[model samples]
Target: MKRLRISLTAQIFLGLILGAAFGCFFPDFGSQLKPLGDAFIRMIKMIVVPLIFSTLVIGIAGTGDFKKLGRLGGKAIIWFEVASALALIVGLVVVNVLQPGVGVSLPAIGAAAGANAAATAQSFSISMHLLNIIPANIVEACVKSDMLQIIFFTCFFGVALAHIGEKGKIVVECCRGIAEAMFKVTHIQMNICCAKLFENYK
Candidate 1:
């Protein structure tokens, strides 16, 4: 007899169904579990910048040809834009259909925060958004989680890294290592989240 084991998908589906039942029966206890959900989300977000940078840099650097990299970048940008637009449209449709926050009341933000947001909106433009992808300070971009700027910088860095020949070999290898580590980290985080989700049942 094969060892009994549940597939990750089935485990997740089970967790969702049982979690809903648990929450319904224990509302106050469920409310205290918000931080687990938030921590899981935060863990996922933490992986994004490093994983993207490392994988993209390795991939672009591996191409070893500026002309080919440019074409690949063009296709990637097109795909990113189309996929993003479609995701936005689908998300809006789902939110409208579900009306998930329909009855929720949000606390008022401070006037200063509102004013800053308004000013930011007033100053924003398509051209500015495009230009902002070239970071004045690459370190700041990474620290702030400015993905576009980071990607823009990574493309250039990858091209330069490739052109450096022997010197770039170590950097490329390091990126490959980092990418693998991040993949493992992501898998571990998912398992941890799954265990946390199911732990209440026991």
Candidate 2:
């Protein structure tokens, strides 16, 4: 009973109820808590990009089987497409039903909009997007935290490491270690965030 009372899920449910009550009764106090939420979001963003990059590299290099990799990649692509489609459909249905932004108004596009469009026009091109997967400056990609470019570069890097056999084990092991470390960091941060949230609710 004590374990159940102290469990994370129980804490979360209690927090949710208390938070809702507080928000209902003290809107101003609730508004003042926004910084805590923002801090949590920042912590999450800090961990996620590195985690994604390291995990992708580890996954590709560790597998070491081209045929298996290809098969799995094909299945992943299909699942991604299906999941994306389903999300779009559900989002459309919910938006139609709720009409959350029905009364919102926006200014008409101006000359600044055209300039913005021109600057980003090439990014929308399929060929350009594909080309951009191969980063001209890997350091720049990592600094900018460009996830797609990082993933693309890592996949090729991992494949090359796999192809090199015993000699490449050192690099692969390093990446795997990094991935595991990042996962632990992320887990710890998430638990900290949850604890803070639970305290705030109290």
Candidate 3:
């Protein structure tokens, strides 16, 4: 059993084959499996915010140097921007070369529909994108599950904790403990979930 569990690649291959077979024979029932996939994604997202916030708070408070943090953040931002630009350029080049849209005939849109699409695209500006990063309200941001806003708030709060000096140490330690506990809980849940998923498939 342990050896079989360790062979994850083979297990995955077997699962795909079995899943395909079931879907082929029972198309109607197979469609219901989509909820499982969606639920798993939601579970991951639910854990991510708290895990990120706690970890960031602990790290920033422990760093003891705001200057170093600023330098590191600058480097990270530069790297991220460069990577995003390169990805965008590559995608544009690929799309242009492939011209996948050339032969595809989309359904004829009415003038109003076409105008709406153009208006929607026009409304999406770089300045609005940047401004959205700053949360109007933290709770509202969390309720909306805006990842960038959550990250911004975490970093801002972490820096504030760092600036508190000695008083922040206790809070930092508490956050570190909470982070560790949450990670352990997540790990256990993941292991149980994976085991159950594999067992169900088998």
lDDT per residue (tens digit) for residues 1-202 in model 1: 3445666677778878877987999988888998997898899999999999999989888788878878987998899999999999999999999978888999999999999999999999999988988999988998899998999999889888998998997999999999999999988987777864333221
Who wins the lDDT comparison?
A: 1
Task: Please provide TM-scores, in order, for all candidate models, with all chains considered together.
Answer: 0.77, 0.81, 0.69
Question: Which ten-residue region of model 2 has the weakest summed lDDT?
Answer: 193-202
Q: What C-alpha lDDT do the candidate models reach, one value each?
A: 0.87, 0.79, 0.80
Worst 10 residues of 1 by lDDT: 193-202
Clash count, one per candidate? 0, 0, 0
How far residue 18's Cα lies from its native spot in candidate 1, in Å, is 4.3
Query: Where in model 1 is the C-alpha error above 4 Å?
Result: 16-26, 95-118, 196-202
* Model 2, residue 61: C-alpha shift (Å): 1.2
Steric clash pairs (candidate 3): none
Over the full model, what C-alpha lDDT does candidate 3 score relative to the true structure? Answer: 0.80
lDDT of 2 by residue, 45-73 (tens): 88766777677767777788889888989
Which is the better candidate, 1 or 3, if ranked by lDDT?
Answer: 1
29-118 in candidate 3: lDDT tens per residue?
878887875776677777777788788898777788888877877998899999999999999999999977787788899999999999
- Using TM-score as the measure, which candidate wins? 2
